[model samples]
Target: MLSNRQLLVLQVIIDEFIHTAQPIGSRAISKKDEVSFSSATIRNEMADLEEMGFIEKTHSSSGRVPSEKGYRFYVDHLLSPFRLSNTDVDIISDAFAKGMIEFEQVVQKSAKVLSDLTNYTSIILGPEVFDTKLKQLQIISLSNQTAVAILVTNTGHVEHRSFSVPANIQSSDLEKLVNILNDRLVGVPIVQLHEKLSDELTHLLHKYTSDFDAAYHYLKGALFDQQSVQLYVGGKTNILMQPEFKDVEKIRSLYSIIEQEEEMAELLRSNKDGMNIMIGHENKIDAMQDCSLITATYSLGDQQMGTIALLGPTRMEYSRVISLVNMLSKQLTNTFHSWY
Candidate 1:
């Protein structure tokens, strides 16, 4: 319901605050070439905007700062479509130009590219397990009582877990179990591994070893127990550079949340396709109240494979970051599609 002048004034305040991270005064808005209003007229608009909850006055200064509501309105209405700088496009293109044959390599590199380009922490959720097929499963025994289970996907991603060998299962039993799983479970989608093991392989495993029950138990504990999605994080320390994160307790909480891979993966997966933005208190997570998160998905054909996200203070460079994320996501989709 804001008039054209009020909208312009709000946009000016937000843009200025984003750039300088300082409360903006009406005199400053008047000084801008895009603003034709005089200082007195602009001050009147600021007062109305503050009354409407779009802007707030800081205790320390007469100047105003954009409230969370102000940021939301700016993103939803005043944001102009932005084109990625040539340097940004080239950086992304060059990063992907190298031959990256594995999914891990591509995802890890993408994470780094985003963090480096934006100077913000970047997170990427690897392709969901349901979409990936098993390429190999191997068990390497460290001792008679302990061993490690390795799961390899067709995309060249590897996961390993250590477990105590069941008392009834010998090294020979482990070998036989691995052979049977490789024969029957290779090429099976990861999401179906448990079902395939129960319905299809139980009898086959019994046929190969007398310790079939122990082997089945071991397999469940070692391999299927791992998380269904993998999280890749770049520039974990980059958030420290933002002025808003100077509070030690806030940084500690944010870092703790970031380290929880399962929680973060779930959060990223919940995002709908295309680009979405959450600013300040709009984010559900308590620790992210002072930040903004921009997320986009990369896909193979129609199926979404993973997510790309950037995290920074709410005073983020929205236009530039939005453009960068959109371009990077498209590049990722093309790269993945080319691989398939």
Candidate 2:
């Protein structure tokens, strides 16, 4: 356990380091308005804190930086409630005031706004379309041999694929197929569409069309082949501006991981509901070992819709980012719930 003075000293050091991304000295803590101690007394507290594994002296200087354990303690015990500035509130309000109609549009805008506000890389995992019930599906003919298959979910998310129509299939058969699909799969969740099609809808297709097997194979491949969740990333280059990421190799490794959308989507999805913080090595991804990940989940009623995350150096503005994420998540939930 830390004394009250020790906790205050640690918080001040971490807060300063977070802002400047530079090591902090006891003299600096003494200069803060809230700190009442002399430099000598603050130095003694700093030494004690470092001995307890909360802070470390950088090799090149006498100034101290918060270690991973220090950051953890600060997040868990020392963080004060952050009040949102009017600018922050205005930015978020303006984004939602644009009359966006789709969930993807709202989430995409949120990601961009978050990145712009904090200058940190922002990632949003869009709601799992599989869990959403199919609202409608249509196949529109662009030409004699080309057509587009469009799928819309109850949440107003749209997915479409354009493919060449098989020569053996007739236009009338396509209409019949769509009618049968709407009748049978209207309320079915998208995740089960494949199994439901194979197990139950195949026989119905065979009864309506002469080229049942070939057409079934083609339609399935065209519509349900790629069902993975979508990941939206913004300000990927913003991480380049952080002083800690000056190393070229570090940037390269981080970029490679971000490029793997599937991996990132899985990582975001694995976080539990509400706010979560992973500092430095606490994050499982090797490339993220030098960074902190702050994630907050947005929901529709009781069901979680997606995650909004900010990634930056371990010396992140945790209080402000946490407040922003929490507010944004609530706004997202309210917007989504209004739809239902």
Candidate 3:
């Protein structure tokens, strides 16, 4: 555990390394970038910081650089909101605002902008189940024994499934139940749908009639299916050109993590409240120990949770990347809310 002063010194080293892609020395921290400290005092702080395993030296000729511990500490303690210049914000906003006909297209544009701006891979996620707000739901009777369930969310994502209903329910009764369900559930949370509907199930069936049992069971089954969950991934190939990941084996390892649905889902679900930066080894994934992940959350309407993230080597562009993502998240929130 280092003192607050020592931690600030380490954060400077890491931020400098990220910006210049060069090893940083004590003189750099002591000199004024944004802080006021003398060179000798900075050197003492650097030495103490190094002893605490936060920064390390590469060679006798080179300056001290941030260690994995240093990066983690810098992110958790010393970081603050990074402000973007007006020019940078305008360029990306104008580029993406041309025409986003579909919500998927908007997500895709975010990935491209992240890669183009920082030259790092970006991951933009759709609403998690907990973030999903039901905009509409209806059951369409295809026949006496089967019905098609259509569900829509405020984010414009749509899901449909064919359910095998109980043999006894008439088409007219199923049609009546559909109207009943829609009025009550139009703005409900997807997470609350099952229990909320279940609470009203007996009342719904009795009100619709005794013939509605089969349709009720089928509706429950449709809601529980995992197909209702959706994941969107783009810019997966953008990081391949970085010099830090030119090695074939390293590239393959990173690809494996991105390809796994569970890995991406776990990453999106994590740290919903604050901007999260997971450094080497601090993240449980062995394959990503050489990389850093910076993630932030965006809200959809009042009911959905969305995430924006950037993936780069341990030597990532911290100030600029943070600024870009923060602004982009607000843009996304504005765009999402304006739609409905």
Q: Indicate the TM-score of model 3.
A: 0.74
Q: Report the lDDT tens digits of candidate 2 across residue range 257-301.
A: 999998999999889888999999989999999999999998854
As a whole number from 0 to 100, the lDDT of residue 235 in candidate 3 is 68
- Ranked candidates, highest TM-score first: 1, 2, 3
The true-versus-predicted C-alpha distance at residue 38 of model 3, in Å, is: 15
lDDT of all predictions, in order shown? 0.88, 0.91, 0.76
Tell me which of candidates 2 and 3 scores higher on TM-score: 2
lDDT of 1 by residue, 248-276 (tens): 99999999999988888888988988899
Looking at candidate 1, what is the lDDT of residue 333? 89
Off by over 4 Å in 2: 142-146, 301-304
Top-lDDT structure, candidate number: 2
lDDT of 2 at 1: 92
Tens digit of lDDT per residue, candidate 3, span 151-226? 7776677778887777777777767777877888778878788787788666877777555566577667876545
- Selected candidate, larger lDDT, 1 vs 2: 2
